[model samples]
Target: MPRATDAPPTATPADAGPAGGDHLGHGLRTRHLTMMGLGSAIGAGLFLGSGVGIATAGPAVLVSYAIAGVLVVLVMRMLAEMASALPASGSFSVYAERALGRWAGFTLGWVYWFTLIMVLGAEITGVARIVTGWLPGVPQWGVALVVVAVFAAANLAGVRKFGELEFWFALVKVAAIVVFLVLGVLLVLGLLPGTDPVGTTNLLGQGGFAPEGVGGVAAGLLVVVFAFGGIEIVTIAAAEARDPQRAVGRATRTILWRILLFYVGSVAIIVLVLPWDAPVLQEGPFVAVLDVAGLPGAARLMEAVVVIALLSAFNANVYATSRMVYSLAGRGDGPAVLRRVSRRDVPWVAVLVSVAFGVVAVGLNWALPDTLLGILLNAVGAALLVVWVLVAVAQLRLRPRLEAEARARGEELPLRMWGYPWLTWATLAALAGLVVLMLADGTARGQLLATAGLVAVVVGIYGVTALVRRRRAAA
Candidate 1:
């Protein structure tokens, strides 16, 4: 059990280049980090995807969201504890390397990178579809291509500029949700101009709150769990903040409660306002609520907001995937060329390579216009589960050492896990249960199998590469 400092350095001096160095720029501020987390977590999942959850479990979908929300809060706490102690662009991947081994780090890094890449494809495709609705003649793939290009350019500009753009994007999402929540509450209470009290009709009357029973709740959990995937970007961005430890601590603390409110609150409102079986739920839950509230042109307005949400998420995922690959390269797990940085302290090569899949997905949109998003979503659903499992394991193994080090230095840890070992273990068990649930459901089983295949491929590649390098050195 070697300590993090005792482990071999993930990056070496040789990795540094003349152009701004190999290191990522510390350009993110506390506000930027906080909003990026919000921007990432609140995207397609809530706006467009939650409808699937409601449809699956009826109002009992709240149970699914609550379960997922609690899991995210615990996982983020574990991640924040580790990130505050040892922040890096790789974030949990770096921690996994130290606490588990290089193999774990390599597998987690590559798996997470691929996961975000798939998510990038989904986000851009989602946005392109929404945009095409506004301009019927524009080709969806064309819009996807333009979006991929715009975000690529924005990411290449530098971290600060990227952070500023994400800040505003997330702000718009948060504001829209706030207004929606207020309107929902007013409408439910019969406070809106011409509306009567909706009462508990939607909640209790909707197939007795669990239309499909426990099986449906399980299915809903599978659908909604992935919504919490992007919140980890906060920990990743912490590496680039002016003060990683302080900024990460603050951001993680506030983000947990906010996410719960936004996700759980919004879902509750939707189910309370509209029938769980409403056909409009499939279209867009947020928009459906607004439309039912009698707001003029609510459909168009919310559709526009959803486009922004998808774009915001697309931008954040681009940043996350590029940094993950850049970190992987720096650590010798990926190609060394990805370590190259631009004059603005941006990982130019990694940014380009990361978005390359989005470009490919543009073609997929053109080819498989109807089914591309569902395919991508199902493929990547279980990836976050794997990543979170690793994060918890890494924290479990590292927390004791971190505490010992803090004690030796006569200081308290900047941020501590809420209930170490106990809560950490509980979170792991909950994640395992989610995996079991995924296996039980037919659709989720496919996603779990796909993610399993991806992880196996990554692990096999890493193992073979390591053996080759070892033999080469011996020869």
Candidate 2:
């Protein structure tokens, strides 16, 4: 890979934007962060998994989305409140370390790192399979490698270039989703030419809206929570923005609304367009609506759209995982070697190591792509719940200090979490309830157990490593 020829960056305070030599370029703008969040939310899951939610909960899936979307909004607000005050590249990891302790930071950071790597593999595997489906002759792992390599190279480019790549990649899917919503709305209202209106029958007729009962909604809730996993990338990107405080504040406010619209709005349209039990529901609700609405090339177009969504996610997650590892390394939680940045101020070494996860992902896709992959993805996703729980805790602990510091300096806080401790505690309770619900579901039970096991391993690693280093120092 090509390297940056620029001189090493100077050391700056850890609280400020990336430390000189250790920093990512502050080239990101508000639009970049906003779109990145949007791109992260509208991934292959929405493109495909929404159909499953519909199938499982029937029209009551709308309620599932509403419940999940509200939780995401509250979680983001809590995160943004802290992030705006303490803009560090490490985001929540730094917050945990500050409010909790090194043990807390190490646990959350590595668990999040592992989750990102596992997801990267899923992304590569999904895209590779898509390619093999189209070409018919190419091997799956081979194509997966090519996709990972291409994005790795793109990520290796300077930060501004990575932003541009993500911006456009995300734009394609955003446009597709918007067009989908418009067409769906028109079809539902009988406003489109030569089309009978898709009335409320599909939503009302299917054993009533909550056809599967509250248990079904509970099942769908677990899936909904996982779908919102990648949206946290916005906060990760926040520390690299030119105006970290302002950019993060603005993006946090708008990103949630946009994500809700894309998820809730689009899913509602699909359910209204076709009954939950439609024979073709398994294919994807988005495609079903397009086909029924007499759209040209619906199947082929959706395939292309899905490919774009996965590739976009692949690119963004590569950027995310690299930065995350870079954060861990910077804190001396991992290899010091990963702390170095390139001439362009890119975390090149970290990029390669993160891409190594993609390599792991490819191998997984080649081997036990079924049960094992499902279990791993679910377990890793559940970690996001832990990260969120800690974020709220961190703010409850840190926000008072942040406010006091601002007062001594005689400056007003730029962003705030609504209702302070009250809302924050409520969000924490909601997260806890969601976890219990997740554990209760038969399908999701395995994943929750896997998460508990993974958490134990992470804590164990931290404890043993800390003990060894302390003894070595004493010796």
Candidate 3:
């Protein structure tokens, strides 16, 4: 009943290959893929940070979001093109190795992994903020600890359960955004109870919409970049999808529209419905908008939604962080223990290690008080954008070889990145500029330092490992 070719390949310690163990189970489906994409894209950024961006850029923040949205779409397209070509558990890390070199893979994988763990810290801190608002008596440290334990346990349950949980978590977020958007649209059209038709005057009325001028827009771009950090998780999750290529392709194609509608659409409505100078934006934009509508139970509703949003982020980060570790282990870049999979087809060691690190972040949030979690948040954004640049470069390097291979095999590539070499280069250049900008600004310098320090550490480890291997070989 079995063919020799059907047997799974065995892995060895010296081989940078995925270990044999129930195959990590391709348990994700199209629905899971879709919701995961939505879940990754929608986060606390929209609810919390949009107000900051709007304040910085005035009405031009809409333009800033649009610009950032395009960049994310392009990056996702580049990642999808690569993922479709060789769908693997290692995701962009594998793409970098195959396209560039072992160094590229080692560096980018750790950087991405670092970003995820740092976000794990930030997510717990964020949840604590919302929680403290509800129960003023509770300490931030205790709340963060409770949130981490709950979400990490959710992640250890296995991919299917994680996907199912995120599906509902994503649904709650999507529903909130949709309801907000509908209310915004209705309010603008003078359709809501006791509300008049708001004209476009709000767009230009608040000090001509560019009160802070071009400099403000540039400053606002930092936060705009952060808003897009989580969008790349879809690529990581795609490797586990039933039809990885199709899922990635479908998700990429539709993701642009979703970002436009949920992010751009919602912000546009907020600017139109309320004055740009509203004090509520200082507190919280999403909360402010609902309170403005004078809806009964709006504050409680928003607090609940924000809590769900934070939990969803924690869940996703743990999943992303563990998968990153599992991938690094599979490729010989991390601890061998991380490569071990459990009966549930989950990477148990990797998950626990990631959770342990998350717990540390929680502890830091409580004890340190004057920590770099806030700075690392910005650094994580820069690092993620840097990862995007690496993915784009990797694709540029590998596309020709991939095309040649397909042509030799008499098969055409079904999905190809549009405008190939030049567009890819432009994306890289744009990311480089962002990094340089971050370096030049006093506020953004911390992000550059964190990202550079992390990169250096990974590179050092890689070099040290290589030296050890060379000495052993000579021995």
Candidate 1, which ten residues in sequence have the lowest lDDT sum?
A: 1-10
Q: After superposition, how far is residue 186 of candidate 1 from its true place, in Å?
A: 0.9
- Pairs in clash, predicted candidate 2: 9-21
Which scores greater on TM-score, model 1 or model 2?
1
Q: Write the per-residue lDDT of candidate 1 for residues 291-329, one digit (tens) a residue.
A: 878899888888888889999989998899998887778
How would the candidate models be sorted by lDDT, starting from the highest?
Answer: 1, 2, 3
Name the Cα RMSD for model 1. 2.4
Native-vs-model 3 lDDT? 0.78
Quality of model 1 by C-alpha lDDT: 0.87
- Residue 53 deviation, candidate 1, in Å? 1.2
lDDT on C-alpha atoms for all candidate structures: 0.87, 0.82, 0.78
Q: Between candidates 2 and 3, which one is better according to TM-score?
A: 2
lDDT comparison, 1 vs 2, better candidate: 1
Let me know the TM-score candidate 1 reaches against the reference structure: 0.95
Rank by TM-score, highest first. 1, 2, 3
Q: How far does residue 262 in candidate 3 sit from its true spot (Å)?
A: 0.8
Off by over 4 Å in 2: 1-20, 365-381
